[model samples]
Target: MAASPTTGRGRPDSLDHMIRLTSLTRRYGRTTAVHDLTLTVRSGHVTGFLGPNGAGKSTTLRMILGLTAPTSGTVTVDGVRFRDRPRGLRHVGALLDAADVQGGRGAEAHLRALARSNGIPRSRVDATLREVGLAGVARRRVGGFSLGMRQRLGIAAALLGDPPVVLFDEPFNGLDPEGVRWVRGLFRELAGQGRTVFVSSHLMSEMEHCVDRLVVIGRGRLLADQSLAEFAATSGGSTVSVRTPQEGALTARLTAEGGVVRAEDDGTVTVTGLSAARVGDLAAAHRIPVHELVTRTPSLEQAFMALTATSVEHRAGEVAR
Candidate 1:
């Protein structure tokens, strides 16, 4: 594994992986929030933790950070439990909730207090503020700031320790387009520095472009864990679109050869259950002149929907007429 560029002062030298969760499970009363989730978050990449509402994402994160005790199993950071670590913040930096900060204090003051408690220098607070673009309003009270500003302040506080493992939960909640773009770049930079960046979000479009690895869960159970490219490649199969002047003849030949064909709106035939190469060859054998033949791969959102269809916890009911 590559070394993290954002290594803090107290980073352990012997550690390899940033986080390891072994059979981690959590429950509340009669309900299970997380079910035997075993995952390893490696360094030098951005991993996206994805799930629908009530899919145990937040519960797992809380367990990893030692904010909530797991009913069973273990979560370790640098081969040590978070609660057992002498200075937990120095090993992992997390932004679980933007509203967790103290409302009465200014942004700078809040960060300074956290730094002081963690034995970090006060100067680091300002530096972090500037890094997250909150230095201009560092003196403004957090309660008076907008949601986006508060989110930035929370991120600044998380970076005060400059830990190798950084986690963000819905960091793009209130961010405008510019802020969202900045966060995307920031995650890439952090990962380039060889740091472990784990972010959780339901926004598949954003995750499609931002994350390298994906850990998808549904209803407290693991659904799929794979790279973005692998996930898309293994999602059933691709559709082949072919446009020919002899649409009727092509459709009949394609269907006869075990291809599911559907007439598209724009005078093209959409072929599934067959490969593009096979379709092209069949068209050639029948002497059908092909104007256009293209294979369309499933988008990230489409693949995710198909994989998690059975795992969705809540469904919008049909409205009353």
Candidate 2:
């Protein structure tokens, strides 16, 4: 699927980054999960936090929500330290993992407890459950919920706060294709309403169609911070396909013009590097008959793999240890 425009290059200057990490670091004994990472998640956009397995995405989010203290640096919400603000959580609603929900309580009871703690009306509990398509199952024990249903229930709890910023970590893990589409639409609608929606996932292919801006990390280090279009342009170059009646003549001409040419089993030559117009011009100049010409755009998933290949952490040692 083609990626739709998520940002129009008019990034707001509100310092309004709903979430910011300044030189954030987290260490687990000898291993550093996140290494002096710094990033800003602006409002009115959905920022995709992408990385490979064990890339410290979950750790960074834990620090941001104050679930775990950063060994160095700081994480803040609206310029206030995550741990220092009295109402630190009032500005952010997060779903770090499906299991974050209490297994002992019913889904409705869980949401009600949070609502009461935050001084939100009881009516909001039902509203959020229904909003997440969990109204029918809201009364069921959370321990009985499927992973996808649990993810939706978690999202319901996050929305219960009605906070300006929402953070989701691998929300699509067990969801079917339709559920993934639903979550994508929900994030877009939230961002459209001028809220900050930050999500993290190891699946770069799915995110290519889901997120606006991307903050990609590998080996616990920042790799690329860019919009989808910019990343595609840098790593996803275009490929040109050409066809001519005289395959041999066209192949010779294209090769001489610095174009990479490969003849298919059928009688046609595919050329790359030269545009269709340039190829046509060359063919016209060489008196070669042109039958067909086209260009195929590369997928964002391919671009992501090409860009992050070198930065991936080798986990062979960890498994052996």
How badly does each model clash, as a count of residue pairs? 0, 0
Writing each residue's lDDT as its tens digit, candidate 1 over 194-226 gives: 778999987888898899998889888988888
Model 1 weakest 10-residue run by lDDT:
1-10
Off by over 4 Å in 1: 1-15, 318-321
lDDT of each: 0.84, 0.79
Tens-digit lDDT string for candidate 2 (1-321): 112223212222342657888899999999999998998888888899987777889898889888899899988887876667554435678888788777878999998888877777788787777777787877899998889888888887777767778899888887878778888888888787777889998777778877889888887889888887787767767667777778888888888989998877876677777888888899899898888888766677777778777766764545654
For model 2, name the residue pairs that clash: none
- For model 2, state the Cα shift of residue 216 in Å: 0.8
**Model 1 clashing residue pairs (backbone):** none
Worst 10 residues of 2 by lDDT: 1-10
Tell me the lDDT of model 1 at 25.
Answer: 90
In model 1, state the lDDT of residue 46.
Answer: 90
Model 2 spans with C-alpha error above 4 angstroms: 1-17, 264-272, 314-321
TM-score of 2: 0.85
Q: Give TM-scores for every candidate, taking all chains together and pairing residue i with residue i.
A: 0.91, 0.85
TM-score for predicted model 1 compared with the true structure: 0.91
